[model samples]
Target: MTSDNKDRLGSKLHDVEAAREDQWARQRDADLLEKMRERMSKTACPHCKQFLVAKSEAGVPLHVCPAGHGAWIDAPALKAVLKEQK
Candidate 1:
Protein backbone atom coordinates (compact mmCIF):
# COMPACT_ATOMS: atom_id res chain seq x y z
CA MET A 1 0.00 0.00 0.00
CA THR A 2 1.10 3.61 -0.62
CA SER A 3 2.27 5.71 2.32
CA ASP A 4 -0.82 7.88 1.91
CA ASN A 5 -3.09 4.88 2.13
CA LYS A 6 -1.29 3.67 5.21
CA ASP A 7 -1.75 7.05 6.89
CA ARG A 8 -5.40 7.10 6.01
CA LEU A 9 -5.86 3.65 7.45
CA GLY A 10 -4.13 4.67 10.63
CA SER A 11 -6.32 7.73 10.95
CA LYS A 12 -9.42 5.70 10.40
CA LEU A 13 -8.32 3.25 13.05
CA HIS A 14 -7.87 6.07 15.53
CA ASP A 15 -11.30 7.43 14.73
CA VAL A 16 -12.88 4.06 15.25
CA GLU A 17 -11.21 3.63 18.60
CA ALA A 18 -12.27 7.07 19.75
CA ALA A 19 -15.84 6.41 18.69
CA ARG A 20 -15.89 3.14 20.57
CA GLU A 21 -14.65 4.78 23.74
CA ASP A 22 -17.33 7.46 23.48
CA GLN A 23 -20.05 4.89 22.97
CA TRP A 24 -18.86 2.87 25.95
CA ALA A 25 -18.87 5.92 28.15
CA ARG A 26 -22.39 6.75 27.09
CA GLN A 27 -23.55 3.23 27.83
CA ARG A 28 -21.99 3.30 31.29
CA ASP A 29 -23.61 6.62 32.07
CA ALA A 30 -26.99 5.38 30.90
CA ASP A 31 -26.72 2.25 32.98
CA LEU A 32 -25.87 4.38 35.99
CA LEU A 33 -28.89 6.54 35.32
CA GLU A 34 -31.23 3.59 35.19
CA LYS A 35 -29.76 2.27 38.41
CA MET A 36 -30.21 5.67 40.00
CA ARG A 37 -33.82 5.93 38.92
CA GLU A 38 -34.61 2.65 40.56
CA ARG A 39 -32.95 3.72 43.75
CA MET A 40 -34.51 7.18 43.78
CA SER A 41 -37.91 5.67 44.45
CA LYS A 42 -36.78 4.25 47.80
CA THR A 43 -33.22 5.42 48.44
CA ALA A 44 -31.90 8.67 49.84
CA CYS A 45 -28.57 10.50 49.71
CA PRO A 46 -27.49 11.74 53.09
CA HIS A 47 -24.75 13.99 51.73
CA CYS A 48 -26.90 16.29 49.60
CA LYS A 49 -30.06 15.51 51.43
CA GLN A 50 -31.40 13.81 48.31
CA PHE A 51 -31.90 10.29 47.04
CA LEU A 52 -29.28 7.58 46.57
CA VAL A 53 -28.59 5.69 43.37
CA ALA A 54 -27.50 2.10 42.88
CA LYS A 55 -24.78 0.95 40.50
CA SER A 56 -22.54 -1.95 39.49
CA GLU A 57 -19.24 -0.09 39.64
CA ALA A 58 -17.27 -2.22 42.11
CA GLY A 59 -16.72 -1.09 45.69
CA VAL A 60 -20.06 0.51 46.48
CA PRO A 61 -23.25 1.87 44.98
CA LEU A 62 -22.09 4.14 42.12
CA HIS A 63 -24.44 6.83 43.37
CA VAL A 64 -24.11 10.21 41.73
CA CYS A 65 -25.37 13.69 42.47
CA PRO A 66 -26.96 15.34 39.48
CA ALA A 67 -27.34 18.45 41.64
CA GLY A 68 -23.50 18.55 41.95
CA HIS A 69 -23.11 17.82 45.63
CA GLY A 70 -21.53 14.51 44.69
CA ALA A 71 -22.59 10.98 45.69
CA TRP A 72 -23.64 9.53 48.97
CA ILE A 73 -22.14 6.09 48.84
CA ASP A 74 -21.55 3.40 51.41
CA ALA A 75 -19.55 0.24 51.70
CA PRO A 76 -20.66 -2.34 54.23
CA ALA A 77 -22.47 0.47 56.04
CA LEU A 78 -24.14 3.79 55.27
CA LYS A 79 -22.60 7.06 56.36
CA ALA A 80 -22.50 10.75 55.54
CA VAL A 81 -21.76 11.27 51.85
CA LEU A 82 -18.62 12.98 50.60
CA LYS A 83 -17.89 15.74 48.08
CA GLU A 84 -17.02 15.35 44.42
CA GLN A 85 -17.13 11.73 45.47
CA LYS A 86 -18.09 10.19 42.20
Candidate 2:
Protein backbone atom coordinates (compact mmCIF):
# COMPACT_ATOMS: atom_id res chain seq x y z
CA MET A 1 0.00 0.00 0.00
CA THR A 2 1.03 3.63 -0.49
CA SER A 3 2.35 5.65 2.47
CA ASP A 4 -0.66 7.99 2.31
CA ASN A 5 -3.09 5.06 2.51
CA LYS A 6 -1.23 3.61 5.48
CA ASP A 7 -1.37 6.97 7.28
CA ARG A 8 -5.12 7.21 6.69
CA LEU A 9 -5.67 3.70 7.99
CA GLY A 10 -3.62 4.44 11.10
CA SER A 11 -5.64 7.57 11.77
CA LYS A 12 -8.88 5.67 11.41
CA LEU A 13 -7.69 3.00 13.81
CA HIS A 14 -6.73 5.64 16.35
CA ASP A 15 -10.13 7.29 16.05
CA VAL A 16 -11.91 3.95 16.56
CA GLU A 17 -9.84 3.22 19.68
CA ALA A 18 -10.61 6.63 21.12
CA ALA A 19 -14.33 6.22 20.51
CA ARG A 20 -14.32 2.79 22.13
CA GLU A 21 -12.56 4.14 25.20
CA ASP A 22 -15.06 6.98 25.49
CA GLN A 23 -18.01 4.62 25.27
CA TRP A 24 -16.51 2.31 27.88
CA ALA A 25 -15.93 5.20 30.27
CA ARG A 26 -19.49 6.46 29.86
CA GLN A 27 -20.93 3.01 30.55
CA ARG A 28 -18.76 2.66 33.63
CA ASP A 29 -19.97 5.99 34.97
CA ALA A 30 -23.58 5.01 34.33
CA ASP A 31 -23.10 1.74 36.18
CA LEU A 32 -21.60 3.54 39.14
CA LEU A 33 -24.52 5.98 39.23
CA GLU A 34 -27.00 3.11 39.22
CA LYS A 35 -25.19 1.41 42.07
CA MET A 36 -25.17 4.62 44.06
CA ARG A 37 -28.87 5.13 43.45
CA GLU A 38 -29.63 1.59 44.61
CA ARG A 39 -27.65 2.14 47.78
CA MET A 40 -29.31 5.49 48.45
CA SER A 41 -32.78 4.01 48.00
CA LYS A 42 -32.11 1.52 50.74
CA THR A 43 -30.65 3.90 53.33
CA ALA A 44 -30.65 7.49 54.54
CA CYS A 45 -29.06 9.59 57.20
CA PRO A 46 -31.15 10.09 60.30
CA HIS A 47 -29.78 13.51 61.17
CA CYS A 48 -29.90 15.05 57.71
CA LYS A 49 -32.87 13.19 56.21
CA GLN A 50 -31.04 13.00 52.90
CA PHE A 51 -29.84 10.11 50.81
CA LEU A 52 -26.31 9.09 51.60
CA VAL A 53 -23.78 9.36 48.79
CA ALA A 54 -21.56 6.45 47.92
CA LYS A 55 -17.89 7.18 48.53
CA SER A 56 -14.70 5.22 48.55
CA GLU A 57 -12.55 5.36 51.63
CA ALA A 58 -9.54 3.13 52.06
CA GLY A 59 -10.66 1.29 48.93
CA VAL A 60 -14.06 0.49 50.47
CA PRO A 61 -17.49 1.65 49.36
CA LEU A 62 -18.93 3.69 52.25
CA HIS A 63 -22.20 5.54 52.33
CA VAL A 64 -21.51 9.14 53.25
CA CYS A 65 -24.03 11.70 54.44
CA PRO A 66 -23.96 14.70 52.17
CA ALA A 67 -25.02 17.00 54.97
CA GLY A 68 -22.00 15.95 57.04
CA HIS A 69 -24.07 14.03 59.54
CA GLY A 70 -21.73 11.02 59.31
CA ALA A 71 -20.93 7.95 57.22
CA TRP A 72 -22.20 4.37 57.17
CA ILE A 73 -19.47 1.78 56.76
CA ASP A 74 -20.17 -1.94 56.59
CA ALA A 75 -18.33 -4.47 58.68
CA PRO A 76 -15.60 -5.12 56.13
CA ALA A 77 -15.31 -1.47 55.25
CA LEU A 78 -15.10 -0.55 58.93
CA LYS A 79 -12.32 -3.04 59.40
CA ALA A 80 -10.45 -1.64 56.39
CA VAL A 81 -10.78 1.91 57.64
CA LEU A 82 -9.58 0.94 61.09
CA LYS A 83 -6.68 -0.93 59.62
CA GLU A 84 -5.70 2.09 57.58
CA GLN A 85 -5.64 4.20 60.70
CA LYS A 86 -3.16 1.92 62.36
Over the stretch 1-86, how does candidate 2's per-residue lDDT look in tens digits?
A: 99999999999999999999999999998997687669665797998788888887766777889999998877765787788889
- Candidate 1 residue-wise lDDT, 1-86, digit = tens: 99999999999999999999999999998997676567664665556666654554554555665565666454432532333354
| Best model per lDDT | 2
CA lDDT, every prediction?
0.65, 0.84
What's each prediction's TM-score? 0.48, 0.50
| lDDT comparing candidate 1 with the true structure | 0.65
